[model samples]
Target: MKNRVDFIDWLKAVGMFLIVLGHYFGEPFDQFTQPIYPKQLGVAFFVFVMGWGLASETRPQWQVVYNRLFPMYFWGVVIAIFISLIFMLTKGHPAITNYLPFIGGINVLGNFFPSNPTTWYIGTYLHIILLWALVMRKVNVTLPLILLVLFCEIAIRSIFIEFERLFTGYMLVSNWITVFMLGMYMHQQKDNHNNLKALLIMVLWALLLFTWASLLNPLNITQTFPFRLPVEHSTLISSLVVSVAISTVYLSNTLLAVKFFSGIPANPVVRFFSRNTIFIFIGHMPLYDVAEPIALIFVESGWGKRAIIVFIMYVGLAVVSELLHKAVNIDKLKKHLWLRLN
Candidate 1:
C-alpha cells in the first residue's frame, strides 16, 4: 500500500506534468512535421493513472470512490464558475446569472460545456466513478474486466452494440474504462522484483503505440471525429503510452527523476512550476486566451515563437493560479461559511 501510494503519487506528478507540457506543445509547427498530436499523453495518462489508482484503492469497497472524487469535482465546478465570471467580465458580457446547461458543461469541463474540449474528461471521470461500484460489483477480476472492456470496444468499433442515443455524455464509459482496467491489472501484477516483466510489458505497449501514432489520421483511413466511431489511433497510442509511462515508474527501481529534480532546486525548469502545478490546470485558459491572441498580434511570429510565448504564459498562469488558490482554500472556506449560515 505504501509503495502503491508512492508510485501513484509520483505517477500523478509525472502524468499531470506531461499534461501541462502537452498543452504547451499541443499544436504542431507548420514548417516542420510533428506527431499527429503532441499534448495527448498528458490527458490520456491522467485517465489511465486514474484507472490504476481506482483499481488498487477500491478493489472491494468502491463507496470510498465517491467520497474521494466528489469533493474535487464539486470544487472543479466552483473553479469553473470563477473562470466563467472572469471570462464574462473580461469579454464585456453581462453577468451570467441565469441557470443553464452551460453550467453542466463547466462543472465537468465539457461533455456539456463549450469553453474547452479537453475538460470533458473531468465530467466523464466523475460520472464513471459513480457507476464504477456497480460495474465492478458485477464484473470480475482486472484481467477479465480488461477483456470484457476490449470486447465492448471492438463491438463499438464494428457497430455491433450501438448506444448512439443512450448516453451521449463523455462520462459514459468506453475505451477509457478499459485502460483504467489496464491500470488496475498493472497495479495488481506489481511485485517487488517483477521489474523485468513490467519492463517487457511496457516495451510491448510502447511499440504498439509508436506504430499507431505514426499511422493514424496521417493516412485518414478512418473518421476520427470526437465522440464518434473509429476511435482515433492517436488516442489509442496516447493511452497506451501513458499506461507504459505509469507502469515504467513503478517497475523501475531507481528514483532517478526525483533525485535529478531534487538536486536542481534552483534550476528554472525544475523550480518554475514547483508550486503552481494543480491550480494552474484549473485557470489556465483565460491566460491562454489572452496570451495566444497576443502572440498572434505579432504579424511575423512563427509557431516556434508562438510556442515559446505559450510556455511562458503557462508559467505565468501557474503563478497567478497558485496565488489565487492561496487567497482561498475552498474547502475550509466552505466549512466556515456553512457554520455561520447554520
Candidate 2:
C-alpha cells in the first residue's frame, strides 16, 4: 500500500518541511529570518494530516490497524527514553517537573494518560485514536462531532476551571474530527470525482483560512485573562483551515510547485517518507534543538546561511530517522512494545 498515494507522501514531505521550519526563529526579514512560533503554528498542519490518515483507514482490518500503529508508537517510546536518559545523564537530571510532565509514556496507562512533557503528544494522540476506533468509528463524520465536543467542554468549563482545568482535549477532538472526516470524505471522492473545479472551492477556503489564522495569532485573541471564552480562540478558525487544506490535497491531487509532491505512495520518495514518517517525527525535536546553536553560528555570519541551516536540519532529520528505522527493522519489531493492562 506504500505504493498507493504519492499525493500523501508529498503532503508528508510538506509536513516534514514544516517540522524543521517550526524550530527556527526567523529574524525580522534582514535578508534572513528565523521565527520562534512556526512550530506551534505549523503543528495544526501535521496534526490535521494525522486525522486525514486515520480517516483513510475506514474499517481497515483490526490486525492491520494495530500493526501499523504499534510499531511507530513503540519506537517513539524508545526514542523518548533515549532522549530522557541522555538528558538526565548529561544535564544532571534537570528538574523533575521540567523533564517529566506527562506520564512515563511506556505502558498503556502511561501512554494513554501521558506524563512526560515531550511525550504529551502520545497521550493526546492516543486520546484521538481511541475515539477514532470507538466513538467516531465507521461513523459519518460531519460538523456535529466537532461542535458537540467543543460545546460540551464549554458547558463544563466553569466547573472545571476551578480545578485549574482547561478544554485542551476538546481542541484535539474538534480539530481532528473535522479534519480527518474531511480527509476521509476526500478519499471517498478520489475514487470517482477528481476534478479541477472542486479544487477551486478548496483553494478559496484555503487562502481564507490562512488569512484568518494569521490574523488571530497577531491579535493574540487566545491569550487573554480568565483564559476561557464562549468560543475558543483559533479552534474554529483552525478547523476551517485544516478542513480546506485536506480538501485541496484530495480534490486537485496536486502539490503546489513541487513535483516530488505528486503521485501514489510507491514512488521511492513517498515510500521512504510514509514508512519512516513517525521516526522522523519523534526524533526531530531533540535533533532540532541541537541544530539551533548551529543555526545561530550561521545566522550571525550571514543571513543566507540561516535557510541553509534549516535545510540541513531537515535533511539531517530525514537521514537519521531513516537510518534508525532501518536499524530496528521496524516491520518485524515487537507487538505491544507498551505494556497494556486489561
Using TM-score as the measure, the top candidate is: 2
Global CA lDDT computed for model 1:
0.46
The reply for model 1, stretches above 4 Å from the true place, is: 1-10, 17-24, 27-38, 58-67, 90-113, 137-140, 157-171, 188-210, 213-218, 221-278, 293-300, 330-342
lDDT of 2 by residue, 159-257 (tens): 333333333422334333444454544443321233464366456646744654464444322221213232342454433332333333322222231
| TM-score: model 1 vs. ground truth | 0.61
The predictions' CA RMSDs to the true structure, in order, are 7.9, 7.5
TM-score of 2: 0.63
> Residue 308: error of model 1 in Å?
3.0
Model 1, 139-221: lDDT tens digits are: 55556656666666544433311323212323345535555665556645332334555466556555655554564436433
C-alpha local distance difference test of each model: 0.46, 0.47
TM-scores for all predictions:
0.61, 0.63
